[model samples]
Target: MLRRIEMRFLRPYLQEELKSVKMKSQIKFQIGKSGVTEGVIQSLNNAFRTRKTVRISLLQSSGRDRTKMKEIANELGDKLAGNFKHTIVGFTIIMKKTGARKPENKR
Candidate 1:
């Protein structure tokens, strides 16, 4: 009886957590020796149409330099159609589409 009551209270919370996890759709891309090419940008744009997050892995051939990775991330962010922000973790770049572009201020 006690176990059943405990489960009933926990069930709703567990379901909500699971739903949140499932809702985050992600896609992965890799940068090879060719680096960031038009094909890559096109594919990433397509992926973003359906997914909210993109995980980009920098292959060894793509160079492991942290500064290079940041540059690539910035380039990708700029080329992408919508507003995006990226975070670099080791050789991986996690880019998420931030809805609505912020208006640029002109002096």
Candidate 2:
């Protein structure tokens, strides 16, 4: 009886911890000469289903221009479903799925 009670209390905490670990581990994708093609978009969509964060690495052939990177990020954001925001750090683009809901105005 005591063990059952202890497990009941610990279950929620364990689940929360697991979720945090999962979110902390990000999936990585690379963009090569082909650039952000349909395959890449589809792969990112699939990754988002399991992960909250994704790291995209722009390869040398993809070009390292900051302006180009921003454009690619914007393009990906537009094509991807749901609310996803990206941050560009060097040649890596970190995209995170946001779960925030818009506030409804009351009259």
Candidate 3:
């Protein structure tokens, strides 16, 4: 009985997660190591202001190794994810925001 209850609760979450993974592969913004700059944080913050998920492609300029990519993900951690919700796959970094986006300029 407990196992059946567990499956019922777990099934939807697993399906949704699979769908998100598929969506993540389709469209993602590209950011370079230069994006690691303070300037890029604002850009990312702005990007999240409008979208729940922001996908970034880390170019060769960002770093050629997975370790550097991990560092970049960590830097985007606090402001981006209060609970460490971001992840890096290959050179791509995916971020998700649950709160409302920031206000856009009128210009």
TM-score for every candidate vs. truth? 0.70, 0.70, 0.60
Largest lDDT belongs to which candidate?
Answer: 2
Residue 44, candidate 1: alpha-carbon lDDT? 97
Candidate 3 residue 53 C-alpha distance from true site, Å:
0.7
Residue pairs in collision within model 2:
none
lDDT, ranked from best to worst? 2, 1, 3
As a whole number from 0 to 100, the lDDT of residue 29 in candidate 2 is 93
lDDT of 1 by residue, 1-107 (tens): 53344345545865454335334534678898899999999999999898877788899999888889989999999999999977665577778788976699998
Least well predicted 10-residue stretch by lDDT in candidate 1: 17-26
**Candidate 2 vs candidate 3: which has greater lDDT?**
2
lDDT of 2 by residue, 1-107 (tens): 53344345545865464345445755789999899899999999999998878888899999888899999999999999888877665577778788778899998
Residue 42 CA displacement from its true place in model 3, Å: 1.2
True lDDT of residue 1, candidate 1: 57
Of the pair 1 and 2, which is ahead by lDDT?
2
